[model samples]
Target: MEASPTLKEQVSILEEQVGTYETVKSSLIEIEEESDVTEEDFSGITFYSDASVKLYDIDSAYINQLLGTYAIVRMSEKN
Candidate 1:
């Protein structure tokens, strides 16, 4: 997936399958915004998985972010 399609390529393909270029481009923009993921600093993890773990990835990322934020608050309280 690293070599995924560029935005232009995706738009062109989608337009061909769906409708007009402008309409497809606008729809893609809206969909992208609706499905946007928050960026976070997640700890490196390694384990064997049958792909179910993939579903937990976003949940765990947010948990990691919350834990980091809590740690920062605790440190500030100590100071």
Candidate 2:
């Protein structure tokens, strides 16, 4: 017969997952901060998710510039 995980074991697993999630989330935030990408709540902007947000085709140069901020920020970077 297969033994099921105990409650404590389950909790430990969940806690580990939570810890990993926190690390990943903080890493993402750090990446954003380091890149100087100022992303305000998109909810406020009119046509933010509707008309303004492009899906498939985006400007490669702009994206590259945004990513480049991760290397060198402040000198030539903006939100």
Candidate 3:
């Protein structure tokens, strides 16, 4: 049978995967923010900032989490 990867090897592979995921997530977020994301871009209804601003990728849980974190940062700054 084939041998499994050593702990070190597994960790290295995981780290690389994490790095790739981070890069893709960052790009997706940037695209969402720069361009207006429509319903076609996401499966759910898009988000809006007040009445004039629009949030991106409303259907993505990751995007929602990022927005929540961003709000927390801004709120902290105000205080």
Colliding pairs, model 1: none
lDDT of 1 by residue, 1-79 (tens): 3644687798778778775766768877743355467877566766667866554346888989999999999999999
Residues 1-79, model 2: lDDT tens digits: 6556797798788887997888888888633235566767778665545777667877999899888876577655654
Q: What is the TM-score of each candidate against the true structure?
A: 0.27, 0.24, 0.26
Give the per-residue lDDT digits (tens) of candidate 3, residues 1-79: 6656797798788887997888888888734356575456455778776979776656688888999999999999999
Ranking by TM-score: 1, 3, 2
Model 2: clashing residue pairs? Answer: none
Model 2 local distance difference test score: 0.74
On a 0 to 100 scale, what is the lDDT of residue 11 in model 1?
71
Candidate 3 clash pair list: none
Better of 1 and 3 by lDDT: 3
Ranking by lDDT: 3, 1, 2
The runs of at least 3 residues in candidate 2 whose Cα sits more than 4 Å from the true structure, single-residue gaps closed, are: 1-6, 30-79
Which one is best on TM-score? 1
- Can you give the lDDT of residue 52 in candidate 2? 72
